[model samples]
Target: MKKIKVMHIIGRLPVGGAENLLLTIVRNTDRNRFNLIVCCLDKEGQIAEKIRQGGIKLVCLGTTRVRHSYRKIRRLVELLRHEQIDIVHTHLYKADFWGRLVSLLYGVPVICKTEHGDVNSFKNKPFYFKAAEYLCFNKILDRLSDGIIFISEAQKKEFEGKRIKMKNSFLIHNGLDTKRFSSSNKRRSQDRSEKLSKNNIVIGVVARLSDRQKGQSCLLLAMRKIIERYPEAGLLVIGSGEDEGRLRDLSAQLGLDGSVSFLGVRDDIPELLAGMDILVQPSVSEPLGVSILEAMYSGLPVVATNVGGIPEIVRHGETGFLVPPKEPDALADSIIKLIDDPAMAREMGEKGRETVMSGFTGDIYTKTLEDLYVSLLKRKCRNRNYRYADLFEIT
Candidate 1:
């Protein structure tokens, strides 16, 4: 059988959720059945190196500073033609715009774009932010993207609210390498145990410390409240961005001088997650929180903002608790509730881990994506469309 030649175009391969999700797909995809190539519209960051390390082909345009560069488009078009790409799968806005335009021009069989939870794009962000090269081009651009995938149903519904309809839309939840998380937890258990005292509690958050959206300030304020009750508690701020200095200032202003630790971007996330007692996501808007799932895989109870697709995952009183965004009081209260009741927190963490294992593993994510790709190619071929269902029959 001839392998499906897939070319994934993206803004960059930074250590972000969308990049990580794309890497998850790249690493987990059945290589024998799918020949993969990556094209980054901007400079290749850390994850791009990891993709190349996997022995896959990759290219970085590095034309971010060159505004309206036709050379970048020409290069992409040439690569698509040279590779005979069957599908062009794109992630992020810049890539979506160029990928769709170039794929249409090159007569690629299909164009698929992953919608990585921009619930705040239209409604929450400032008008200027929305105006700056935004792709809410709605139905017009949707026509070119043969398949539009929403990482969460909340994101799809947000788009639907705008009456934007497109062909070949689907919902595919992101997944984690639960086995890797499980093994890492076992190995790091003894090490993390040494840091834990009988009265100590560690609250953690793994998110980019951006100026907007992530709501780290809210978590810091909540930590001040947590300290009043559990004085031994400390907050672990993982990842990094432009807001680090401002967040650090806020930490000092709140008299949480030593209570919060900003570790910045670290490669050993699985090991770090092991050291956490409870995970909190205070994002004012999140299509879905990948860190929540990662924490769940590591057996940590989650406390997240109730907005977006989070309600679908947290399940209120079941796996974890959800609070309204920006309310430091409510956020602190939820965290305090977990801290006060150790047995309940453990039970919730156990339940959360079970949910991840049952539904959101790498195997399930890979198969669903592979099936989607096969179906898209089959639909085009059924012009004698091939049936992805048939592939399942023989395998």
Candidate 2:
């Protein structure tokens, strides 16, 4: 059987949930069935080298200026034609915009877009921005794209609430290599030397310092409240972004500078998870948290906001506590609960690991995606005509 040629298009290779999810799918997919290549629409970042080093083909179009989309699109269309790509799967916003546009012109057999989040993703956008979602995404691209994948059912429902009727979409929960986190500590010698004091409880968050969405400001407030009750409790913030300066300033203002450590963009996430007693995802809206999964798999209790897909994963009492979004007091209270009862926290962490092992693993994720590919291809073979009712039954 001839292997199906598939190309994954993304804006960049930055350390993000969508980028990491793409890498995981590429790493786990069966090569015998699919010839996979990654096309970075914008520039490459930290993970690009990792993808290239893995012996998979990677193409960077070097799109810098706003006007370069035309040139990039032309180059991409030419590449897709030359490679005879059967499927063009795009992740994130920029890629979804340009990649799908190019694929439509090039006439690829299958075009799929994965929604990392839902309509809530554009909550605080300007008037024109909301118009783009209503017109560009809902009107034009919804019909053009072959299959739309939602990371969780909550995400799908949220998208539907925007009065957009998706023809071909499905819910495929993200997965990871559970074994990676389950392994013994792989923290560098320097990282291994650093440990929370005997009387101290370490709470950690692994997310970018973004301007919005990630409620890092609220987290700082929560930390301020936490430090007063449990002076022995400390917070570690991993990952860097544009909002770091502001967040750092907020930490100083809140007097949490002493207890909170902002360790920016570490590649060793599992190692970081090992150093912490509990993981906190204080995002105002999370599609799904890979860090939370990694923490749970690492046998660490989680305290995440009850928003978007988070409730689907963190089963409140079972794995971790889910507090209402933007509530500093509630967030602080949950973290304090885990800090006070180490035994209960440990038990929750163990159960969290079982959840990942049973339902979320790299193998399960790859297989589910493979099944989707086969099903789509079969549909294409059976119906040569363009119109199909719904592309996803991911239930």
Model 1 bad stretches (over 4 Å): 65-68, 119-138, 179-197, 384-395
Quantify all predictions' global Cα lDDT against the true fold: 0.81, 0.81
Model 2, residue pairs in steric clash: 168-391
Model 2 TM-score?
Answer: 0.91
Clashing residue pairs in candidate 1 are: 381-384, 381-385, 382-385
lDDT at residue 266 of model 1 (Cα atoms): 80
Clashes of each: 3, 1
Position 239, candidate 1: lDDT = 90
lDDT of 1 by residue, 124-149 (tens): 43454356436545455676667899
Model 2, C-alpha of 291: deviation from truth (Å): 1.2
